[model samples]
Structures are given as structure tokens and as C-alpha cells.
Target: MAEFNSNCSTTSDQDDSIDIQQLMEDIDFDNVYSMEQEINEYETDQFNIMYNTDDDDDDDDDNGTIEKSVTLKPIEEQIKSEKLNPLSTTIVNTKKPMTLKYIQDEIEKIPDYLMKRNKVFKQLIYETLTTMSISTSTNNMEDLRKIAISIYKIMVIQTYQLLWAAYLKSGMRQLIIPSKTQRAYSTMLPIWPKEIKLLLQADKHVNENETYFNFINAQLHELDDQLKQNQMKLNIKANHFQGYTLSIQNIIETYIEQHLHCLRMEIEHKIELIQYDYHIQILKLEYLRHKPNTFQKQLMKELCHSKYEQETTEQEVNLLKQQITYYTSTNQSFECLPIAHNSLIDSIQNSQIRQQLFLQYKDVAKQSRAKIFALYMKTAKEQRDEYKNKHEINLKKMWDAYNSTSDNDKISSTMLDLMHQRCMKISEYIKCIYKFKSQSFVSNSKS
Candidate 1:
């Protein structure tokens, strides 16, 4: 049992030792990875500075000369050698004299090749050598060192490839030679390194990109505002057009209504004229049926004659004769004796006798005139009384006739009712026309 326990303890110790060794290997690998990352970062910063310096050199010839003078060939050659043998142990050890500053200067000499492959290469390199540092020994230290150097060389080669790729992408060779704006055009290319140093040194590129984006956004906003304004204008114009159309419609309706009203009034007037003419013709026919005298017929014919008919007929001559007869009859005096006495007195030559005769005649004439006046008044009163009695009787007869519903009376009443209805219809039509006109006026006023 003790032998079994001792064997288990020994196995446990070996396991613990293996675990410790694995832990140490893991630590060393982590350290080496971190160092590689730092070196890559440093190289990146150096390339960025080199790109920025190239840009500055484009602006000023003196700066360009100064940058060229500082360039070291030894470091450039060493970096080139490292690129050629990235995994070779001999190159890394042989190039041990190369410093960080020399490496930075050397980066400027190489053209950018892996311009868009930096991140991809970094990730691939990290993943490819997961267990890079596994053994821990005096002999393994050299191997470890070679591994570290090889990693550094790989980083350097990748950086050089990136620079070369950028240079190819820039199409610098395609630019027009002997052009004053060539330097400015070259600066516009997006082949520069994006490290922090270049970002800080070439702030103008960042500013220009930001400015371009801002300008685009502003233009979009302006276009949107213009669209909104155009829409509002269209709406306003549409409203105006609608209002104009309505006004035109209303005007047309008003004109139509007015024309119709004028036509109606003309038609009504013509109807009234025709009805008057018919009434006159009917009355003339009734008079003729009642056996009117020649004189009465002549008068009515003359009254009813048109202007042309009157000119051709004997109405003017008859009218003149009637006027002459009326004047002759009006001129005759009623007292014959007074006229004779006046003639006799005018014939007397003796003034006193003439005066005595005139006085006696005046007294006699005055007494006779009084008697005639009294007789005339009595006759006039009797005639007036007779006329009043006749009028009353006629009125009573008319009332009885009106009350009685005889065939003739009924016919007359029916005719009268029909005429009344016609008149009422005409009045109602006029009222309707007036109402329509008033309503139209009210609507127009509101509009």
C-alpha cells in the first residue's frame, strides 16, 4: 500500500511539473505576442510619419530636400534583407545592429504593397502560431530568440508590402509629368497610412472629408425645403384656380338667369298685348251683333284701325265733321227774346229813350231769367230723382242676377273664376321668379 501511494505521488508531481511548464510556455507566448503587437504598432507609426513627411515635402521643396538628406541606406538595405528572408534565423541575427529609428527610416524607402491587408495579416499571423513558445531550456532560448526575430521580420515584411500596395494603388506613375498641380493632385490620393501620427500631421485630409459630408447633408436639406415650398405653392395655386372656376360658373349662371328673366318679361308683355287686342275685337263683334248703327260701327272701326288702316280710311274726315258740329251746337244761346231786345236797343238813336228801354227790358229779363232758372232746377231735380230710383232698381236686379245660378250667370261666373285663376297663376309665377332672383342675389353677396 505504501509503494502504491509513493507511485501515485510521483505521478502527481510529474503532472504538476508539466502543468507549471505549460503555464510558463503560455506566459512566454503571451509576452512574445504582446511584443510583436507593440513592434507592429511602432512600425505603423513610423510609416505614418514617413507618409506625412512625403506630403509636407510636396508643399515645400526645401522640406523635401531635408527629408531626403536624413534617409539612411544601411537601414533600408537591412529591412529589404529581412523582407526577403522573413522566416530565416540568419537574417534576424545578422541584422541585430539595426535600431528602431533606423527601421523607421528604412520603412520610408519601401513602397506600400499590402495597403488593405494590414488587419488580415495581423490576425492570420496571430492565429497561425498559437503555440509558438512551448519549450523552456538554455538551447530553446536561442530558438525562442530566433522565433521572436522571425516574427519581427514578418511584421516588417508585411509593413513593406502594405506600403508597396498603397504606392501601386495611388497610380502616381499615371500623373501628368511637368504639371504645376501634380503635387496637389498626388496629395488627393487615399494611399497614405492611417496611423495616429499621420492622422495628426495630415489634419487637412480629415477636415476635407468631413467638410464634403457636411456639404452633401446641407444640399439634401436644401432640396427638401425647396420641395416643401413647391408643394405649398401648388396648393395655393390650386385653391386660386378652384375659386376662379367657381366665380366663372356663378357668372355664367347669373347671365343665363338674367337672359331668361328678360325673355320671360318680353313674352308676358306680348301676351298682355295679344289679350288686349282679343278683348277689343270681341267687344267690337258683340256691338255688331247687337245691331249697332252705322255711325257707331264707323267710330269703333276707326278706333280699332291700325295706323296704316287709319290713313287709308275716312276716319279723319268723320272726326273733323263731328268736331265742327259740336262747336256749332255749343255756340247757340238759350234765351231768344233777350238777344232780340238787345238788337232793338242797339238800333235806337235817342240816348234817354234807349236808356229807359234798356232799364225796363233788364227788369223784365231778370224776372223771366228767374222763372227759367227755377223751372230748370225743378226739371234737373226730377231727372236726378228718377235716375236715383232707376239706379237702385238696376242695382237690386244686378244683385238678384248675381245671386241666381242661371245657365248664363253660371257661365259668366265660371269664366270669371277661370280668369282669376289665370291671374293668380301669373302672379305666382312672378313671385317665384322674384324669389329665385333674391336667392341668387344673396348667394352672390355671400360669395
Candidate 2:
């Protein structure tokens, strides 16, 4: 048991030693602590100027020159004044040797107020990096250095933005680049190293790129606004077109309807006139078909003349004498009655003969009256039946004409309605085509 316990203790110690080595290899605590200490020192202390060299302008030995000394109090005061008013700071000419310490000192010569601001900014950067570092598996030195440099570059860009704002607010037309040859009291020294120069060049390039991007964005926005305006105008135009089309269609339909109504009324009037003309022709044709012949008319006239002569002989004689005289004056001969007719007239004038003739005439009249009554009754019945049949036929003809006219009217009305429907459909199709064309045009314009 003692040997096993000893072996376990030895293994635990070896494991602890291995873990310590791994931890030491993974994280260089010394380097991190040292960097933090340098940052703190830089934050707290003011920059130191170690050496100053100026060319002497005195006449002495050819190889020898006098040293012009600078008072420390005045240098401190000047440096303080320069830190307070960076824009008014002037470049100082010196022959100072370039060194790492010298460069670092120059960079750390920021104003106290700016240094205070840097502390807060640095803390924020550290906090942000701490959060980002938690997600990563390992902290490679090179990767950490790159991340720090990138953060610093972003910070520098932000500082440049602030400086740019100040420059704009100052309303200065141009920025004068500092040079050794063009020294001025208001100008800064052109003593920055190659790295700072390169950084400044990069910032300038970034600013130019941003300016170009902004210009392009503004142009694109203008184009977009123009397109929207065009779309709105198109919409308004379409609306106006649609309204005009509808108004015109309404006008056309109203005119057509009015014209159709007038045409219908005219057709009805023409039909009535045609029916009246047809009825008049039918009456004229019936009168011609039933008209008396010339032979019958002559017989009726002779009977009436004979009845008149029997009723009044003296009036007949006087009328014949006038006719004879008129014929003689006209050089035309008159034909007298026959001998048998004269004997009959003399027999009628004798009383005895007239009495006998009267008895015979009475007998003949009674028999004839009976015969005439039978003929009159038969003719009257036949005429009444014929008249009834004619009336029925006329009524049937009139009913057939009315039905035919009504059917024609119905067919014409149906045809007119169909034409109207077709017209409406055509108009709707035209409207749809117009709409489709408008929509397609709009789509094409958009594309």
C-alpha cells in the first residue's frame, strides 16, 4: 500500500509539472504584463526631449562651430503652448538622430486632455477584444498583434473623421503639406516616419474612395426618384386615358341608342303606310272584280225608260218631240216606234179593252207577286250567307297579316338585341386590349 501511494503521488506531481509547462507555453504572461505596464507609463508620463542640434551661423575657425543652447524652461512652456493649440504649433529645425526611443517619445507627446480621452477609448477597445477573445481557441501572438493593429487603424480613421469635421468647420480652402523647404510658424514639422506617412496615404485613399461612393449613391438615388416620378406620371396618364375612353364609349352608346330608336320609329311608320296602301289596293281590286257588264247596264236603262213612258204618256211624247227636234237640228233622222207598239198603246186607251186588260193584269200581277216573293226570299238568304262567309274570310286575312307583322317585329327586335350585345362585347374586348397594352408598356418601362 505504501509503494502504491508513493507511485500515485509521483504521477500526480509529474502531471502538475506538465500542466504548468503547457500553460506557460500557451500564454506569455510576462509579455502581456509588460505591454500593460508600458501603456500605463505612456498614459501617465510626458514625452522627454533628449537632444537638440542647430547649425551655428557665427564666423569662427573653418571646422569649428559654437553650440547654441536652448533653455529648458522656455522649451517646456513652448511645448505646453503647442500641445494646447496644435493648429498654431510651428515646426522646429533640429539635427536629432533617429532612434526607437526618439520616435516613441515623439508619438507620446500628445496633450494631457487627449491622453485622458485615450484611456477611455483604450478601455473600450480592451473590453471589445476581451469579448472577441473568449470565442477563439488560442491566442496566437501574430494574430493578436494583427487584431490590435486593425483596431488601432479603425480608431485612427475615427480620429481622421473628427479632424475632417474640424477642417470643414474652419472653412479652410486647402490643406498645406509641411516640407523642410517651406518652413512657416503656423506649419507642423514633416518629421513623421515612413509608417505614419503610409498610414496617412491610406487614409487619404479611403477618404477618396468614400467620396466617390457617396457621389455614386447620390446619383443612383436621383435616378430612382426620377423613375418613381415617371411611374406616377404614367399612372396618371393611364387613368386619364381610361376616363376619356369611357366617356367616349358612353357618348357613342348614347348616340347609337338614339339613332336606333329613330330608325325603329321610321320603320314602324313605313310598315303602317305599306299596310294602308295594301288595304286600298285590295278594295279597288274587289270593286273591279264585282263591277256590272255593259249589256246588263243597257237592259236596266231600257226597263226604267219603259216604266217612265207607261206612267206618263204626255211627258214621254214631249220628251220624244224634243229629242226629234234636237236630232233634226243636228241633221240626224229619228227612228219611230213599231206598229205593234202603237196598237198596244191604242188598246190601252179604250175603256172596255182597258177593263178586260186590267182584270188580266190583276191576275198576272198576283201570280207574279207570289213568284217574286219566293225569288226575293231565296236571293236574300243566299246573299246573307255569302256576306257572312266574306266577312269571316276578311277577318281571318286581317288576323294572319297582324300575326305575320308581329312575328317579323319580334325577329327584328331579337336581331337588334343580339347586335347590341355583340357591340358591347367588342367594346369590352377593346378595353381589355388597351389595358393589357398599358400594363405591358408599364412593365417594359420598369424593366
Candidate 3:
């Protein structure tokens, strides 16, 4: 009975050990399965994040409490499919090498807002290439090295091509045409070369690449030559414009001089007539003082019998009216003569006779003064009219000449506008060239 109890206990212990081993095996299997599922989910998330894609079904699955196991192909197969159908792929498989065209397309795909974001642009390119190298097969270092070299070459070529294309698109060609006739006159000066120099100073990366530096130096020389030619053309055009302006100025000056000369002559003629009239008045007054009676008798005879009798009578009446006006204006007595003329007479009868002779002489003097003044005014008006007519004729001639020159292709407005456009384009082109050159330098340094 004691032997039977001991054997039964050993058998039970053996069964317990077997059951425990089986349980351990089942737990290990479950853990491995759970780990695989987790890995699959992580990979799916990576794909969605890298490719910037989302699936509605995936979102629903993620939200659910239940977990599902997924079977996945090798990383290489997945990358190949992504490369073959890039648009359809939900992940960026960086194992594939990027072509020059691909790089160019990527650059073009960058938004305009991102173009000036130099750090961001460089970071994107760096991350893409680094990811590609990391994702490549470990056993294929040789292939990886080749791919890296190809990427460097692609970067250099793409940068150069982008800059060249920008230059072509710019209107630099308009500034320096091969044909002289087609060459335009630039009114605006370009500061692009100076701006490019400043850009180069700010970014020293391009100077590190010998090939890029050489190419840029050659282009700078070409651009300098083109700018010099444009400046020369502008100078010539400016000179021509100045010549026309000077000619117009000379015409205006000559017109002013002629008008002044006419005015001076008219003034001199009026002065001479006034001087002659004053001398005649002085001589008549002297004759009346020396021989008043004789002078009076002669004056009366001339006034009564001369062919200008009516004119003489009118002159006498005007002189008498002037004497009356002077007496009234000065508040003087009409019975007395003026003080300066009082010495010329002796008695009251003689004074009366002398005053009559003086009044007749004054009438002739007044008439001469009125005639001279009228003649002077008429001459002045004629001179003014002549000046105006001549000035109009000169102005018309100038206008005709200007219009004819402009219309007949002597002055080219289109050339001026084209040159201004070209100057602006050159500035833009310089900026693009500097930008790409700096990018190329950065890419090469990293490689």
C-alpha cells in the first residue's frame, strides 16, 4: 500500500510539469504574434506619414478596439512598387535613386513661397538623400556610393540648368542684340551685377566649387560686356536727345533777342522825334521873345491863308483848352500868366500879344507831341505782333521737326522701353543665378 501511494504522487508531478511546459510554449507564440502585428501597424503609419496620404478605412481600423494582423512584403518589394507607381503609392520609398529630371520636377514642385526659404529647401533635399542612403540595402555599399555620386552630378547639373533657363527667360537678349539695328537704347541703369556680387559675398559655398566658380566667372564677364554695350547705346541716345533740346533752346533765345532788338529800335526812334520837337519849340519861343509883333503878324497870316488853316485853328483851340485845365488844376488866377513867361513881355498890350503868340506856339508843340506818341504806340504794337507771328512760326517748325523725327524712326521709343525691360530682367536673372549657385555649393558640400 505504501509503494502504490508513492508511484501515484510521482505520476501526478510528471503530468503537472508537462502541462506547465505547454503553457510556456503557447505564451511565447502569442507574444511573437503580437510583436509582428505591432510592427506592421508601425510600418503602415510610417508609409502614411512619408507619402503624406490617408485612407478612410485605415482611420476606422485605427479607431476600433480590436486589433488585426497584417501580412507585409519585403521592404525592397514595397519600395519598387512605390517607385513604379509613385502617384498611386501611399509611401515614399527612398531606396530608389533619383534622376536629374526627377530632381528638377521636385524643385518645380516647391511652392513659390518656399523658394526663398533657403534653409527649408536645403533641409528637404538633405533629408530625401539621407533617407535614400539609409533605406538602401546594407550589402550594396558600392551601389550606394554610385547613387551618391549620381545625385551630386544631378544636383550640379540641375542647378546650372535652372540658372541658365532663368537667364534665357530674362530679357537680357534685348539689351545686346547681335544686329546693331535691333540693339536697344537703355535709359535705365542696372545694378544687378553689384547685387550679384553682394550675394556671392554673403554665401561662400559657390566659391568652394571650382567648376561652378569658373562657370559663374565666365557668365559675369559676358554680362559685363553686355552691360557696357547697353550703356554705350544709352549714352548715344542721351546725346541725341540733348542735341535736340539745345537746338530748341537756341531757337527760343534767338527769338527773344530779335524781339528785344526791335523794341530798342522803336524806343530810339521815339526819343529822336521827341528831341527834334523840343528843339523846334525852343526856337519858336526864342523868335517870339525877340520879335513878338513880327512873329504874331506872320503866325496870323499863316493860320488864315495856309493850306493847313483848319489844322492850325484846331491846334489853337486845343492849346487854349490845355491852359484852362492847368489854371483850374493849380488853383491859379486866369488873368495872370505863368511866372516863367512873365519876363518875356514888357506892357499889358505887349504881354497880351506875347501870350497869344506863346499860345499859338504851344498849340503847334502839343500837336507834334500827340503825333509822336501815337506813332510810337503804333510802332510798338506792330513790333509786338511781328514778334508773336515769328515766334509761332518757329514753334511750329520745331514741332514739325520733332514729330517727323519721331515718326520716321530717327527716335525709337520701342527701343527705350525694351531696354528698360531688359534692365529689370537682368536684375531678376542675377538674383536667380546667385540663388542656384549657392544651392549647388550647399549640395556639393554635403555630398
Which candidate do you rate higher for lDDT, 1 or 3?
Answer: 1
What is candidate 1's lDDT per residue for 235-346, written digit by digit as tens?
4543543222433334323433443443344334323322322222223333334443433333232222221121211222232233223322434232332222455455
Compared with the true structure, all predictions reach lDDT values of: 0.31, 0.29, 0.30
Global Cα RMSD, each model = 67.3, 68.4, 56.3
Estimate the TM-score of every prediction.
0.18, 0.14, 0.17
- lDDT (C-alpha) at residue 154 in model 2: 30
Ordered from best to worst TM-score, the candidate numbers read 1, 3, 2
Steric clashes per prediction = 13, 0, 0
Per-residue error (Å), model 1, residue 299: 26
Per-residue lDDT over 239-333 for candidate 2, one digit per residue giving the tens place of the 0 to 100 score: 54322233332432343344244223322332222222222222222222333233322222222222222222222223323322332242321
Q: How good is model 3 by TM-score?
A: 0.17
lDDT of 3 by residue, 1-447 (tens): 000000101122122222222212211111112222222332332221111112121323222221221122221232223321111223222221122344445534533322324454334434443544443233233332233223333333333443433322221222233466543232222111111222333344443234334444555455445445544544454354312233332432343344334223322332222222222222222222333243232332222122111222232233323322432343433224222232223233665655654454334333432343343334334433543454445434433433454443221333233323322332232233223323332333233
Could you tell me the TM-score of candidate 1? 0.18
State residue 355's C-alpha deviation in candidate 3, in Å.
1.7
- Residue 345, model 2: lDDT of 23
